[model samples]
Target: MKKIILTIIYILTLSGCGLEQDSYLVRWWNGNIPTKLSDKKEKIWDICFEETKYLPENTKEEKEKADMELNNCLHEKGFWD
Candidate 1:
């Protein structure tokens, strides 16, 4: 009985509410974007989504690198706002 309860708890924890609709990468991007990039929000988001959408969110360092790369891509495209 305890094993069954533990299994149920693990399943519930893994499959948290709204996990399908919003990905970890998307949430991270949404939270980490600089305020200066807000004026051109749509295009910035598009670049970010397009460039980093396929990146693996496995570690904090990877995520930070992805964010830096996204910012660099935006700056390279001259999309300052």
Candidate 2:
């Protein structure tokens, strides 16, 4: 029982590493993108777009809204510098 409990705990800890690992969270119009914590502005933006891509069911209007929200979010995060 002890050995099984330790194994289960180890597996759970390893799996949880993939969840909520990103530090910076940006809520956009239709969805949100999270990024690993980094000081590089370009990296943050790249992660945002890469992570927040639309699905097949997403409408064009939703995409447009997300674009506008992304721009606003970037500006608010001071990427304009």
Name the best candidate (by TM-score): 1
Q: Flag regions of model 2 displaced more than 4 Å.
A: 1-39, 54-57
Query: Candidate 2, which ten residues in sequence have the lowest lDDT sum?
Result: 21-30
Which stretches in model 1 have alpha-carbon errors above 4 Å? 1-41
lDDT (10s digit) by residue, model 2, range 53-81: 55232789877777886777677667767
As for candidate 1, its clashing pairs are none
| Local error of candidate 1 at residue 24 (angstroms) | 25
In candidate 1, what residue range of length 10 has the lowest lDDT sum?
Answer: 32-41
The most accurate candidate by lDDT is 1
Superposed Cα RMSD, model 2: 11.7
Query: Which pairs of residues clash in candidate 2, taking residues 3 or more apart in a chain or in different chains?
Result: none
What C-alpha lDDT does candidate 1 achieve relative to the native structure? Answer: 0.73
Q: Candidate 1: how many backbone clashes?
A: 0
Q: What local lDDT does model 1 show for residue 13?
A: 83
